[model samples]
Target chain A: MRRDFLLSFAGHVLVVGIAALVGMSRAVRDTRRPIVFSVSVVSGGGTPLPQAGAQGTTLVESKPKSQAKAQSTAQSKTPAKGGGGSGSGTFKRQGLGVGVEGAEALGYSYYLNAMLTRVSDNWLNPYAGQAKVLTATVVFDIERDGTVKDVKVEKKSGDAAYDASCERALLVTDKLPPLPPEFPGPRLKLHLEFEQKP
Target chain B: MVPTTGASPGFLGPFIHAGPFALVDVIALVLMSVASWAIVLRKFRTLGRASRQTRQFLSTWGLRTRLGDYEQVAQRLRHSPLSSLLLAGVKEFNALRAEFGNSQAGPELLQHMIPNITEAMERAASREVAKIEGSLAFLSITTMVAPFMGLLGTVQGVLVTFMTLRGTQIPTLQTIAPGISDALITAVMGLVVAIPAALFYNYFVGKAHELEGDMERFESELTGIMRREIVSSQVEQRKGQ
Candidate 1:
């Protein structure tokens, strides 16, 4: 009986030690704040500005007054400079834009809009009050469950903070709305740009 | 559970900040879990050996006609409860025959002999059952008490959290999160300890009950065989006279 007790005590200690090791080995998870957005009601509040990194004729597009109105009115917005265009024309041009592939045919424009708002909410510009305009382009893959992966910088905006803020925004927005069920694909690859202007 | 002050809170923050009461609860649960697991292992080996030896004894005893034919098999199956039970009955039968003289036993004396032998086997069966069931009570007690011990820690931790908040102008998520997480750890630990103990306790109890039933059946069969052996020997002696 004493021998059995000793054996069991040793076995229990080993099991607990193994479990604790496994638990400690796992990476700690990151938690984030919820997203929030504000809407403006008045018109003539501003004139259009040149889209950042615009190489050719700078189309001075009017700022769409609201997110819902912007999507409906500007469905034909052309993809500008390597798959980088805003899903909605919001005025607060806060260093965040998304360009989705095959979004219109899949009727998943709302998914893009959600991605923009969520990423923009987390996207913080280090040079928020500076007059220097900067734009950094990043590309990444979005799995079906909305997990971001394989994030890489395609274009650097010449400023380290500006580029890092864009990367951090995407990394921190770890989850977005899941892809539309009608869209049949293993994952969606996305190209995005973060533009900071005075 | 004071708020962690560093730029990056360490992963072991909750455990490190656990109160005195919570630490005690954790220690108690850990000991209970270890003890319960020990009983599970020991009972497993004991019951398994008992079952295997009983099977061997029964198979060998089945081939033998005379009561004396069992002595060799019984010696080899010392761990078998059935063997011990049979030995008890046979020993009583031999003593009775010695007292009455093998050739002179009447039907009236035979009646008393059967009951005495049955009584002896009954005593041996109970002893074997007690040995099999030993230490199982500790498992039962652990299952019932570990959960409540965890709950006590949780309640104490929460109470401490609220008390800390009494002086604050406002309680924000950052202010209360650490304390609440510390409190919840004990509850999780409690369930971890109790679940396996409960499962193993039920299992060992069932095995012990099964062995007891087997012994009871063997006792009745052995009694019937001993009675017939006594009666047949008396008949042969009368014919010889």
Candidate 2:
């Protein structure tokens, strides 16, 4: 019995040793997901005029310096008459953007842009690399108290997984800062097009 | 994307979040694994010795004409159940010889000695078999219990996971992944502990039975030899008278 006890103890030690070795050898390397969310603003009106001047305000990657300079210069030449907001109208290359429906014209694009950053920060892609390209458009309304309502998918990326992820991103960001007190409207409508390219 | 954080990371990462009940389950399974392995190793060594010694004892017995010639040999083959049976038979035969001397010996002597000797061998056989089969019950119990214990841990973990989902946030993979990990690790550990125990238990049981059979066959063979020797000696004594 004593010998068996010794042998069992040795066996357990060996097993634990091997397990520790394997675990130690395993590289807990950083896993960088390549899915970047870029939003295209479809202003409240029917036209899909991307805010030409508001290009550089994305989440991660910034647009090239030359292009940003050119857009800033171009904006100065022809300031978007009443296209709204008082921030850089320059576009960023591959980063997060906001699609403020008609808020830009009302000069609330800056507020909506900040809100978009918060939502994107909370966004976690469930279908990170499942497809080459995925795009899901979601529409929702923010009450005067900043609570989101009537979140629905406006366009499906043909993949339920991607659609669900986009919806979840919005649902997870259930509340946002209250609409700017200066804004006239009781609520703000948003049309966010979430796209992932390779 | 954001580098995933907040959850403890590693292969045993889920164990960090294990609740009180889950912790108990893990510790119990580990202990079971250790005890089962100890039993397995000890049984292997014992069964091997028994087999090797029994083979040697049988070979030695085959060469000897009389059971008395094997007394010293049986003394040395302690692990062999056959040796114990032989000793029991030889001891009974000696006792019967002292009771009935050559003048009293007859066909009735064979009848009386054979039954007593067989009974003694049977008693020794049962004792040896019991020794060989000892501690096997623990293996059987471990095989049966470890998996269910793991399952219990898993069910409890998932229950807690769902219960926590009642909070402000809707259930997402992030919110649910840790609890699910805790549940799955227990199940995986359960199978790990059970599979080997089950395999070794079956193997040891079979070995014990084989040893038991060996003792039974040796008993009958030894009894036959002892009977033949007695009959021949009695015939010679009667002829001289």
lDDT of 2 by residue, A1-198 (tens): 778888888888888778767766774442322111224421121212233213223322212323333443233221222232333332332211221212122255555566665555455555443445766778787765778888899889898986887787689888988877655444555656666543
Question: How far is B152's C-alpha from truth in model 2 (Å)?
Answer: 0.7
Model 2 chain A, poorest ten-residue lDDT window?
Answer: A95-104
Tens-digit lDDT track of model 2 for B18-78: 8888888999998889898888888889888998998888787775556675868887998
Summarize candidate 1's per-residue lDDT along A1-198 as a digit string, tens digits: 778778878987787677667656763442422111211111111212221112111121112224323554344444322212322243322211221112122244456555655666566666654666776767777766788887777689898877887788789988878766554344566656666655
Q: Write down the C-alpha DockQ for each prediction.
A: 0.13, 0.15
Q: Which candidate is the best by DockQ?
A: 2
Candidate 2, after superposition: displacement of residue B90 in Å?
0.8
Instruction: Report the C-alpha lDDT of model 1 over B128-214, residue by residue, as the tens digit.
Output: 998989889998998898888888899999899988889775464445766877887788888888998899889888888888888
Task: Please state the error at residue B212 of candidate 1 in Å.
Answer: 0.7
Q: What is the lDDT of residue A37 in candidate 1?
A: 22
